[model samples]
Target: MADFIGPRLYACYNCRNRVALHDDIVSKHFVAGHRRRAFLFSHVMNLVVGPKMDRRFITGLYTVADVECSDCGEVLGWRYEKVHEESQKYKESKTVLEKFKIVKDNW
Candidate 1:
């Protein structure tokens, strides 16, 4: 017999709704507002992207939208809609999930 394993995922802390896959993470050393740790993911699922707005961060100014869990409407993080700095262009379309707002699943 063979052992079975599933894809590692990150779920919303409030609802356990799977939001992102471990494989989609671009960086795990990101810092969110209020000095909170966060993860940058290339793709995410089961999330509701809120209104787009310009927010200034340590890196630079960016147009972003808050991403909430579809199941419970909990604010998980934000998605980078537009990058104003050329050096930070790679972050466009990426999602940043707060570490405290997510729990690990299937791992």
Candidate 2:
């Protein structure tokens, strides 16, 4: 018989609430505020997107909303609601979860 495995997940560091999936990771090489490491995820679940605000990043200006854990309300990262630069449009609707804020689950 063959063994079965489940989809790998990333959980909130504080409450252990499942937030993202390993397969959904778009890029591991990302940086958040204050030089903190981050990961770009193509999809995330159990998260609440906060208000949209304009912020300027190294790439360009974008409209983003803070994403929080739906269970515990912990701020995990931000989601790109709108991208101003055409070159950065691919990042729209994506979420960036801080590395330190998430822990591996179902590994």
lDDT of each: 0.97, 0.97
- Prediction RMSDs, each to the true structure: 0.7, 1.0
Model 2 lDDT at residue 64: 98
What 10-residue stretch in candidate 1 is worst by lDDT? Answer: 1-10
What is the RMSD, in Å, between candidate 1 and the native fold over all Cα? 0.7
TM, every model: 0.97, 0.96
Candidate 2: Cα lDDT at 48: 98
Off by over 4 Å in 2: 1-3
What is the C-alpha lDDT profile of model 1 across 3-91, one tens digit per residue?
Answer: 89999999999989999999999999999889999999999999999999999999999999999999999999999999999999999
Residue 77's C-alpha lDDT in candidate 1? 96
